[model samples]
Target chain A: MTTREIILARLRAALAPAPAPVEAPREYRRDAPVDLDRLVDRLTDYRAHVHRVAEPAVADTVAAILPAGATVVVPPALPPAWLPATVTARSDDDLDHTTIAAADGVITAAAVAIADTGTVILDGSPDQGRRVLSLLPDLHICVIRTAQVVANVPQALSRLTPHRPLTWISGPSATSDIELNRVEGVHGPRTLHLILLP
Target chain B: MSRTFLGMPTTAPKGVGHLRGAEPFPAAARRALSDAQLRRNLGHATATIRAKSGAVVAEVPDWEQLRAAGSAIKADAMARLPELLEQLEQRVTDAGGVVHWAADANEANAIVVDLVRATGSDRVIKVKSMVTQEIGLNEALEAAGIAPVETDLAELIVQLGEDRPSHILVPAIHRNRAEIREIFLRAMPGVDPGLTDEPAVLAAAARRFLRQTFLSTPVAVSGANFAVAETGTLAVVESEGNGRMCLTLPRTLITVMGVEKVVPTWRDLEVFLQLLPRASTGERMNPYTSMWTGVSPGDGPQEFHLVLLDNGRSAVLADEVGRQALHCIRCSACLNVCPVYERTGGHAYGSVYPGPIGAVLSPQLTGVADNASLPYASSLCGACYDACPVKINIPELLVHLRDQAPHPRGESAAMAAAAYAMDHPALYAAAQRATRLSRLTGRRGRGLPPPLSGWTADRDLPEPPAQTFRQWWASR
Candidate 1:
């Protein structure tokens, strides 16, 4: 028999005497009230820059996070109204390593945001682009609407589709692997700027 | 040597590094205990991690509920492992990814080596994976003349220092910053001579050294944190972005995951995502979590391979009482909180796994007789059970494994004789009076004689009462 057959057969025999599968009790606190202030607090606690802005000031907030003449990569479906005129914004339609890496930062809208953990989930939606567009850049400027913010992980997960690629960004890249001491910024975007649209 | 993969009597795998070691845990732990440097490093690192884990875990009011959910989800998945794996394989295959199965380490290594060879890349970048360590993948790749570059900072430190990973999450926890600086200067080609002992500086040095490799390496090998059977997505949760780089940049991605890592659905991640970060790194969320459902048209790896490794997982699954060891999420929470692990460190455990989880898991995977000493490595303090994210009752499992382990003939005979004597009143009284005779040999504050001296080396045995408890009861 093939190794696959052997392994499957082995699993069958092993699980024969095993007890029937039981649905895990979901008694855990699945619902928590979402608060924009709490989200900002959590994000800032992880050293991520959180910018609270009005709908009209979203572009200005993005501009404020970047320097003049900086090249920003945006998803093809990003709203043109959210782009500041002063900075250079390019659509990541034909993303190559050079273009994505050369861009100063990526501006993408989040599919869902977990307020408790300060995490923004991007599911490669039209506006979110591919996972690479946001990962290769040195800075990731994630825009999340207040309405999209959920209180906890379960709430955020409930809102996401599993088939699409997802990237969950809590803060800027950090590592505690060195002597178990946390040092922020390793391989992914060194800087994470969250623009909260309230 | 040929052994059965349950029924198939295939050739024995060449490098199944996860098996039990030749050296016993006591002797190895004795060597580990005498190393002052290892003791200090482990002592400080575990203490820091333990405190941080406690603080973050406390922030979530329903942490226990989350742990229960995690455990139940794993149990459910394990109960229907074969069906979940079949579903996972089909989903992955439908999503334009290839799936392979390996009976043991040799077959897994051969598949991976062949994959890398087919890519025609002499070098491959690696994300930190415990499965790869367990399979001795790097050594296998090196033997095949392929250079595997470890991209994770701690892994890089270990690789450059020519040392094995002591800790699971933080592979280089045993190394101090100064030692790391010296290693980087000596081993990392073109590293700045002016590098300081600051963690930031060392991390930056690793980034500089590995950036080109990440960008250039065509093939990447990784271990999955979880594989969802529902949608066939694989998740890699990590603090540093090295995992992201390896998961994203490489053209060909091969994930070698144990069969037990399969979860029923992506929804189950809500429990694990919360449980793992708080337990492993004390973070509300790890900095980067990448999830992919096979190959995306324009994103991530264009070619993907998922190798399901059985090495010893099926053997472990066969035992009804022992199968819960598969519920481990590799969080290292138990290791940090374990009193025994804190003093002896990870090296003494011998296997790729160590500490409380290792005590139960190693024996189960390799058979209790092969790793007999591991089950006795614990002091049964039960700290590991409290700290375990999945609520694995490690102390109970340790005792269970100890029962399965082979005892020395003399020890077994002594236990049997005692059991026999205790069953009979006359024999019990005679045995008790025989033990009291030894008390007359030494006066108060004197050392014990030959065979009993080994016991007194650590603590003095209390003097026996003049009359046996049964005799005193009878007289009263």
Candidate 2:
């Protein structure tokens, strides 16, 4: 018999006196009022820069955040209007790792944002592009629409499609490995700028 | 055949993996307790995490309800593990991914080695995975002429120091900042000569050291924090961007997961995702969590292989009362809260899994006889049970395993004699009166003689009261 068969057999035999099925309790809060203040508070707690702006001002915000003469990588379907006029915007259609690494920053749209956790979820959507686009660059400028912001994780998960690849960024990369001290910026984008748009 | 005689044996097969420590828990704990430096590191780290975890857990009004839901979800998954695993395999295979089954660590290791060799990549970057550490996967890769690079900062420290991980969340919890700086200066290539012990500086040094490797490594090995059986989605929760670097940049991604890690549905993640971050690292949410289903074209790794590893997990599942240990999410909350763990540290437990959870789990995985001393390693403080996100009753499991552990003949005899004496009032009285003889030895009995000396070796033997309780009661 194959190892799979053997393992299955063992499991089946071991569970001969099968345990009774248990129903998981879903008593935890599933939804709450979306509090933008709470979201900003959480984002700020994680050391992420949060900017609340009008939808049309996204370009200006991006431009202000980036250094002068900076080149930013954006997903292929990212709104052209959102691209800063001051900085060079490169699409990630045929971007290589070296180029992505060398880029000053990355800009993308989030699929959903969790207010309570300060998390932005990307579903490999047209605007968010691939996972690597946000990972390789030192700076990540994620734009989240007010309509896409949810109160908690459950609401965010329900809004997301599981089959697509997902990256949940709570903050710029951080670690608590040294003496359990939280240090921000390791291997991932050191600077995370969240542009909340209405 | 008699019905009673036909019962099945549920214990795990012997000589399988790294579950057992070379010496018993007491001996190893003795060595660890002597290391004052280790004690200080563990004390400081655990205290800090406990405070952090406590504060975050307090922020949620429904934390208990969440814990209950998390526990039930895991129990439901385990009760129907076979079905969930089969469903997961079918879904993963349908999504342009390959799934392999390994009954033991050696088989799992061989499968990973061959897959790396087939990719023709001699170096594979790795995420910090407890399961991989449990199986000693890095050593297996090295034996096959493959170098495994650990990307997690704590794991990197452990690897460079050629040290065993002492804590789950922070592997190098035994080392402080100065020690980490020393390790980096000695081992890290191209490190700045003026590096300081500041955490940010050390982290930047690691980022600089691994940046080129992350960009170039063709293959990566990871362990899943949770795998959704329904959607074939795997989630890896990490702090640093290294997880993303390894998961995204590598051409071939291989994930080794314990079969028990499978959850019934994607929706079940809400409970765990909330409970885990609060209980671990005391954060509302960790910095990064990556979830992928099989492979994504023009996205992350196009080639994906999921290895479902048993390695005595089925054996752990066989025991009715003992199986709850499988419900652990590896949060390390129990370790941080455990007093015994704070004192002796993870090395004393002698398994990749340490602290209260390990005390119960290691014995069951390797069988009671192999890891007998581990069951007694705990003080049954019930702190781990309270701290567990999945509500695993670790103290209960410890007491249960202790019942199954072998006891020395002399101890058993002594217990039998005590029981008999207690059964007879006259004998009990005589025994109590005879205990007054111990007072002759002084206020504190220095040590007992012969077979009983083992008990008093590490513990204090107080002097017997001058008057027996029975005599005092009669006089009153």
Task: Kindly list the per-residue Cα lDDT of model 1 for residues B1-476, writing each as its tens digit.
Answer: 22244553222243466556658988889999999998998899998998888999998999989989999999999999999999999999999999999988888999999999999999999999999988889988999999999989989988999987888899888888888899999999999998999988888788778878888889999999999999999999998888988998889999999999999987899899999999999888988899998899888899999999988788788777788999999999999998988998888898889889988987777667778889989889999899999998888888888888876575576678889998998988887878777656575425566554544554555677888888889899
Extract clashing residue pairs from model 1: none
Give the interface-residue alpha carbon RMSD of model 1. 2.1
C-alpha RMSD by candidate, in order: 2.4, 2.4
Runs of candidate 2 with Cα error greater than 4 angstroms are B1-17, B440-445
Task: Report clashes for each candidate as comma-separated counts.
Answer: 0, 0
Model 2, span B45-117: residue lDDT tens: 8899899899989999999999999999999999999899999999999998999998778888999999999
Interface RMSD of each: 2.1, 2.8
Question: Candidate 1: lDDT of B413?
Answer: 69
lDDT of 1 by residue, A122-186 (tens): 98888999888898888999888999999999998899888788899989988998778788888
DockQ value for model 2: 0.68
Q: Model 2: clashing residue pairs?
A: none
